[model samples]
Target: MGRVAVTGGTGTLGRTAVCALRAAGHDVVVMSRRTAPGLATADLLTGAGVEAAFTGADVVLHLATSRGTADRWQTQTVVDAVRETGGTARVVYTSIVGVDKVPSSYYRTKLRCEDLLHASGLRCAVVRVTQFHEFLGDFFASQRFSPVLLTPDVPVQPVHVRDAAAALVRVVSDDAVGRLPDVAGPQVLDGRTAARAYRDARGWHRPVLPVRLPGRAFRAYGAGHLCSPDAAVVDGVTFSGWLREQLGSAALT
Candidate 1:
């Protein structure tokens, strides 16, 4: 069994990856700022608590979010820590598809992080994935009061979080580097369809108002920047299925 370190180990995907690794009989170490049981605390931004966590680790799964300028610095810090502690460690970075096509600040930061990882001179695997099913809930919360769900005129291929996690696990277990084919949902669904599905599943009375999103970011999304049409390996529960499960559980309460 190999020693694996998972950053953002408390997050949805990270937690799932940790569980999968443990289930496979691998020694798993969770790295995050919050002190959870069996977790190694580390602040990637300042690199204050990473070395000890990385010690003896054979593989590092990087899933932390570097927001703003801190994103670049934290990525560098993590890369450096991996180099200093375990030079031969396999670094697996989870990234978003079409990071270069989108002009959003977050995507830009993700691209920067990818660049840093590539230049770090470590054995690395960069896996890009489409939007997650959880994004629907986040969107609902962000626009709760709106009579209609306003979304960009973009095509989305949303995948389940578990599927994304599994892909990352595979990358960590295999010999791969650079950009792997993007991972996406089984089917491509537009924003309007997704929003309506979300609303109907939750019994929300809001109508889905599809708006043409402006800017380079929106253009990139509309141009299918977040999906991989030719990707061979696809996994995960479908979005509709996941939504139904969530709504069903909520209704039972």
Candidate 2:
């Protein structure tokens, strides 16, 4: 079994990855800002708590994200820590698809992180994945009282969190390292469809209003720049299937 460390292990994706790794019989360490049993406390933004977390790790799965501009620093710090640790063989970084094509600050930061990982001289695999199904729910929940879902007129290939976790585990277990093909869900669905699915799943009686975002990011999404026509890896769960599993019969619209 490999000694594996997962940053942001408390997060949805990270926690799933940790569970998968442990199930696969790897010695797993979860690094997060908060303290949990068998978890190493680390704050990537301040770089205050990473050294101990990274020590003696054979594989580092970087799944942490920072708020705003701090993301760049956090990613660099993680890369540097892995390099300093010496025994680290593979650095698996989770990035968003179409980071280069999207003209958003978050995507730009993600691109920068990818660049840092590639230039770190470490054996790295940058796995770009489509948005998660849960991300849409979170987005809708961000606003209160309006009871209306607002979304850009763009297509998205949303993958389940479990599928993403499985893919990450596969990469960590294999010797192949580099920019793997983009990972996406099996089917293509637009934002409105995703919102409607969420609404149905939650039994939410809200109107979903589609808004066209005026930017390169929106255009890229509309043009399918964020999706891979030749996706290297495809997850099994469809968006509707995942929603039904999560919400049961309530997911039917």
Best by TM-score: 1
Q: Which stretches of candidate 2 lie over 4 Å from their true place?
A: 142-148, 204-207, 232-235, 250-253
Number of backbone collisions per candidate: 0, 0
Question: Candidate 1's residue-wise lDDT over 1-253, tens digit each?
Answer: 7899888888888888899888877899899898777889999877878989999998988887757888788778878898888598888888888888888999988998898888888988888888888886688668877777887667888788878877777777777888877788776778777777777777788777888856777788888888876762454566678887777722210
TM-score of each: 0.92, 0.90
Candidate 2 lDDT, 1-253, residue by residue in tens: 8888888888889889999999988898899888767878888877777877888778889898866778889888888788777836588889998988888899999999999888888888899998887876678767546768787677888788888888888888887788987788777778788778777776778898988877667777799876765663444687788778876855533
Worst 10 residues of 2 by lDDT: 226-235
The top-ranked prediction according to lDDT is: 2
After superposition, the stretches of candidate 1 with alpha carbons farther than 4 Å from their true spots are 232-235, 249-253
lDDT of each: 0.80, 0.81
